[model samples]
Every structure is written in C-alpha cells, then in structure tokens.
Target: MKALIPTGDPAEPVVLADVPEPVPRANEALVKVEAFSVNRGETFKLEAPAPGDRPGKDIAGLVVQPAADGTGPAGIARVVGHPMAGGWAELAAVPADALAVLPDTVSALQGAALPLAGLTALRLLRTAGPVLGRRVLVTGASGGVGHFVTELAAAAGAEVTAVTRDAARGARLTELGAAAIVHDPADARGPYDIVLESTGGETLPVALARLARRGTLVWFGQASRTPATLDFFDFFDGPESAVIRHFHYLDADTGLGDDLAALVRLTAEGRLHPEIGRVADWADTATVLTDLRDRRIRGKAVLTLS
Candidate 1:
C-alpha cells in the first residue's frame, strides 16, 4: 500500500512512498481504501508532514479484512467516535465497532467527507442549544465543517447568518441557507441563539460580544493559524454572558453520538447537502495534503480509492 507521510519537515516530508499493507487484528477491520480527505484545521497547522505520518483523518472505504475475533465481524470503524489511525492510504486498520453503515445514496467520496467535519458540525449544532426558529450564526460558512454547520442549522429551521471572507464564495453560501453572507461577522448585528466558530483569533471575542444574553458560543477547530486567546470579561459581557460557553472536539473524553445521530438523519433524508471541493484518487494523497496546507482547496478535498 502507498501512504503520504507527514514529517516534521514541511518542504519535503509529505511526499508519497509505498509501504507494507496492514492486517486486521481482533476487534479491527482493514479498510480497503476508497476515499479520504484533508484536515488543515488542526494537525497540519501544528506540524509539517513527516515520513510514515499520515495526515488525512477522514476516510470512506470497504471492509476487506475483518478481525479474526468476534469483537468485530464486518469490520467497520467510525468517523470520530474512536481514535483510529485515520484514513489516508490504500488500506486502514480500524476498530470494527467504529464505522457506521453507509446508505446507497451516499458515495465513497461523500462518506469520506462525513466523519470529522460532519461530527464537528453535529456537536456545534447541539451546542447551539436548539434552533427551532431562532437566528444563528456560523463563521467560516463555506469550508468543509462550516458548510455542515450551516446546512444543519438551516434544516433545523433557524435563520442562518453565515460569515465568509470571499465575495464570490459568499454568493454561493446563500445557496447553503445563509440568510446573510459577509466577509466578517462584525458587520452584522447578532443577538443570536448560537454561533459556531471555525475561524479563531480576535474574531472569537467579536462573535461573543454579538451574542444574545444567555446565548451560547460553540467553537471547535481554529483555522486562522493564530494562537487562540480570550478575555474573560468579554465572555461575561452579556446580561448573562456574551459568550455563555465553549467546546473542544480534540478532547478524547467527549461523547458526541447524539450530535452525529442528528447529522446522520439529515444526511440520510437528503435534507443536508454536502459540498465537495475536489475529489482526488488515493494515489494523489500527497497532492491533497499539500493543497489543504496551502489553502488552495475550494471546498472539501477528498481522495477516492474504491
């Protein structure tokens, strides 16, 4: 099998190389690589791709090698429920219990887009505290996770306010259900029920100040490539709190299936529309990695195998 390794060296660490195939263990499944996508949100921003270090985390593949142990039979791994080494090559070994059954309507390329970004969006939607008819805001609305958050919020009947940096992309964000699209959230008067933040830095403080009293701020990944900092006074500015809360997806202890369930239902029903930026083959994993790090991607960048 071939894999793109993320080394400490950014200039040359991400090149591809052929490696031995992995075998499934008890409670594990060897996924015949079908599709995988890039996550420039966290891991890549921290370190460059090194040898043997696969950077892509989201995957969509078939179960070829099931575990010999009964702990897993059809061998499936989940998107973010567990820490599977991640999907970035021709084959990936994951715990059988982790994967969810893919419906016929969703393609492998689409499945790969679901796991991480989808789950993160789910968690944010839940953290948003319900949107039956409330107005909500989603920052970074055109990117992968942002798109999910935007669509999920809209389908739930909330008037979604999407914040985007580019004008051309802002036009399309309206198609995703954004009531208003702009380069910055500061331009909008909020008092929103919830705001999901993918863009970090000074903007986080600004988002909080715009929140309604008792409003919640559900933030996850930071894509601004700036160190995250916040003023406690700013968070407590509202009659209750300008920013009532915060959340983290990188923490391994949080359980988010309820959020994922919400996403699965919407996806299964076709209420949610997934926007794929570009689809690449498994052999092109290195290119996907480079494109994401360089921020050249238009939407979700996926690598397909099957």
Candidate 2:
C-alpha cells in the first residue's frame, strides 16, 4: 500500500512511499479512502516531521470491511470518518463510532471536509447552549472551522459578527449567514453572548473583553501561533460572570458518528455548506500542505485519490 510518510526533513516533510497496510481492530472498520481533507494543525506537525508521524484525520470512503464487533454501517456503506491518524492512505482503519454514512447528496470531497471543522462548529454551538437571539462573535472567521461557526451560528438565529481581514472572504461569509463582518476582532462591537475565538495572541483578550454578562468564550485554536497575555485588570472591566472555556472537538459526550450524520443531513438539506477552498489529486498532497500552512487556501482543502 502507498501512503504519505513523514521524512524528518523540514523542506520535504512527507513523501508517498510503500508501507504495510493497516490491520483493523475488532471495533474498527477498514475503509477504502476516496478523499481526505487537510487541516492547519496537521501542516504544523508536518513542519517538524517525525519518522512515524501519519498526517491525516478526515477521510471519506467506502467501507470495504465492517468492524468485527458488528458495529458501524454494514455492507459497503459510503461514509465519512474521523480517524486518529493515517487517513491519507488508500485504506484506513477507522473506529466504528467515528464513521457516519453519507447521503447521496453529499460528495466524498464534502464528506472529507466535514469531520473536523463541521464537528467543531456543531459542538461549539452546542457548548454555547441556546443561541437563538443571542449575540455571537467568531474570530478567525475566514478559516474552515470559522466558516462553519459563522454559518451555523447565524442559522441558529444568533446575531453573528465574523472577524476576518479579507474583504472577499467576508463577503462570502455574509452570504453564508454572518450578520456583520469586521477586519479585526478589536473592531467588533461588544456585549456578545457567545464568542468562538481561535486566532489567539492579542486577539483572544480583545474578544474576551467583548463578552456580555454570563457570556461563554470558546477558545479552540491559536492559528496565529502566538501566545496570549492577559491582565487581571482586563477582566475587571468586563461583563460579570464571563466564562472562558477551552474546546477540544473530541471531548464531546456524544458519539462522532451521530454528529457527522447530522452534518451530512444538513448538507443534504442545503443548510450547511462545506467550504472547500482547494481540491487536488493525492499526488499533490505535499503542495496542498504547503498552501495550507502558508494560508493560501481559503477554507478546507480536499485531496482526491486517483
């Protein structure tokens, strides 16, 4: 089998090489991968490549073999999955619980784009509780998860303020459902009921100060790669009982399959759109990773198998 393996070199982080095929566990299903999406975090890992680092998490494929434990979809189901690693391969052993059958309306490319970003947006909204008629702010509102957060938050009736420096991307976000767009988080008006922030660094404190009373700030990523500094005085002037919560997509109490199914359903219903900014052959995975790391791609980047 051929898979992308880390080469331990910064310039050429990964290379397609012959490797042993994965053997699925009893609770896992073997999928013949059709497409997979590249994420920002994965590109960071690629920068400091390790010998055994496998760089893939989102995959869409056909279930060639079901779990031995009799879980997951039975009989050659078309599915999207969130695997721990190695999803870039021609085949992946995915946990049954993380696999969701995709509707015919959803393409493999869309499915590959859903698991990480879509799940994060869905769960972030869930953590914020009821968003109807609330004020929500999403920093780093131009990326994959941010795009989903903007659309989902707006669809739930929240007055969404999306922060992005790009005018073109902001216009698209408005079309997707953002009520307002700002070039920076500092430019956004405050008293927000919920804030989904991921840019980190100076942006985190600015977004935090905008929270309303009892507001929840869900911090998920630090795309800027800079550390945030906060002063106690900054919090003193903020709303009462403001909460800052760290979010991990895998921390949900619900199974991934259920949430993935919901995302696919929404896509099928034309409510949620998977924002795929780049599509290329798996042969160009290295180039796609570089584009993602350099922030050249707008949203999600999907690689199709030839």
Candidate 3:
C-alpha cells in the first residue's frame, strides 16, 4: 500500500511511499480508501518535522472489514471518517466509533471533504447553542470550515453574515445563504449572537468586540499565523456577557461518527454543500499540500486513490 508522508522540505513537504497494510484492532474498521481531503492544519503540522513521517486524517471509502464487534456499517458499505493518522493510504484502520456510513447518493469526493472541517463546523455551531433567528457571523467564509459554518448557520434560521478577504467569493457565499457579505471584520454588522471565527491575529479582537450580550465566539483556526493579542480593557469594558471560546476540533469527542453521519445526510439532501477546490491523483499529494498551505486553493482539496 502507498501512503503520503511529510519530508523535511519547505518547498515540497509531502511524498508518497510504499507502506505495510494495517491490521485493525477488534474495535476498529479497515476501510479501503477511495478518496481523501487535505486540511490546512495537516499542512501546518508539516512545518515541524513529523515524528513518524505519517500524515493525513480524513478519508472516505468502502468497508473492506468491519469492526470485530459489529459496531458500524459493514460488508462494502461506503463510509467517511477520521483516523488519528495514516489516512493518505489505500486503506486506513479507523475506530468504529469514528466511522460514518455514507448514503448511496453521496460521492467519495464529497464525503472525503466532510470529516475534519465538517465536524469542526458542526461542533462549533453546537457549542454556540441554538442559532434560530439569531445574528451569526462567520469569518474566513471562503475556507472549508467557514463555508460549512455559513451554510449550517443559515439552515438553522440564523441571519448569517459571511466575512471573506476575497471579494470574488462573496457571491458564492451569498448563494450558500449568508444574509450579508463583508470583506473586513470591521464591516460586519455586529453584536452577533454567534460568531464562528477562524482567522486569528487582528481579526480576533474585532470579532470579540462584535459579540452581542451573551454571545459566543468560537475561535477555531489561526490562518493568520500571528499571535492574537487580547485587550482586557476592550474586552471587559462592556459586553460583560459576551463569551470567548477557543475551539480545537480534537477536543470535542464522542460524536464524530454521528455528526459525520448527519453531515452526509445533509449533503445528500442538498441542505449542506461542500466546496471542493481541486481533485488530484494520490501521487500529486505534494502539490495539493503546497496549494493548501499557500492558500492557493479556495476550498477543500481532494485526492483520489486509484
């Protein structure tokens, strides 16, 4: 089997190499991967040399072997999931608890895009509590998680305002159901009930300021790669009720498989749409990682395993 791993090169970090097949534990499922998606966090991890040289987490495929305990979909059922690592291979040994059975109507490409980003967005929204008729704000609206946040917020009847640095992608976000689009954080109509903010640095302070009373700000990603400086005076001056919460996708556990199942169902029903920026052969993993790290790709990038 072949798997993609990070080499110690800044210009081109990922490389594909032959690897031994994994033997699943009694509680795991062996999935024969058909497609997978590259995530920005995975690319960021490449900056520091990978200890085991293993990469990848999100995968969508058919079940070759089900869990020994008979927990999830079995016998050639299509599924999407996240392994701790080594998902950039022909087969991945995923915990049965993390695997979601994909509907027949969804493609592997779309399902592959769901696990990491989709789960994060779902969890963030869940953290923000009920969004119906509330004012919600989503930053980095063109990115994978951002798009999901925007769509999910809107579907829940929230008045969604999407923020993107790129003007061109604004129309697509509006189509995704954002009630309004703003290019800068300052332009966002504020006192938002729920703010799903991904970009850090200068934007964080502004987003915090926009939170309404009892509003929740779910900070997930640091795309800016700069430190976020918090002003105690600015944050505490007023809006004492506003809450700032930093969300790391990995922290919320126990519902990944169920959340992924719901996302797949939403996608298949056309209520949630995943934006696939590019699709490439598995061998082109290096290029895909480079594009994602450099922000050359607008949305999720998919790699297909032949």
Cα RMSD (angstroms) for every candidate in the order listed: 3.3, 1.1, 1.3
Better of 2 and 3 by lDDT: 2
Query: Residue 24 in model 2: shift from native, Å?
Result: 0.6
Q: Please give the range of 10 consecutive residues that has the lowest summed lDDT in model 1.
A: 75-84
| Worst-scoring 10-residue span by lDDT in model 3 | 246-255
Clashing pairs in 3: none
| Per-residue lDDT of model 1, residues 37-151, tens digit only | 6667634633643334555557666777766676443644323222246466777876665555566666766777777788777766766677989988788777888788777
Q: How much is the lDDT of residue 119 in candidate 1?
A: 77
| Model 3 CA lDDT for position 90 | 89
What global local distance difference test value does model 3 have? 0.88
State TM-scores per candidate.
0.86, 0.98, 0.96
For every model in order, what is the number of clashing pairs? 11, 0, 0
TM-score of model number 3: 0.96
What tens-digit string does per-residue lDDT give for candidate 2 at 1-306? 999887766556678999899999999999999999989888888777665878789999999999999999985999999998999999999999999998888999999999999999999899889999999999998999989989998898999999998999999999999999999888998789999999999999999999999999989999999999988887977879888999898888898999999999999999999999999999888888888888899999999998
Candidate 1 has what TM-score? 0.86
Best by lDDT: 2
Looking at model 2, report the run of 10 residues with the lowest lDDT sum: 6-15
- If the candidates were sorted by their TM-score against the true structure, best first, what order would they fall in? 2, 3, 1
User: Model 2: what TM-score?
Assistant: 0.98
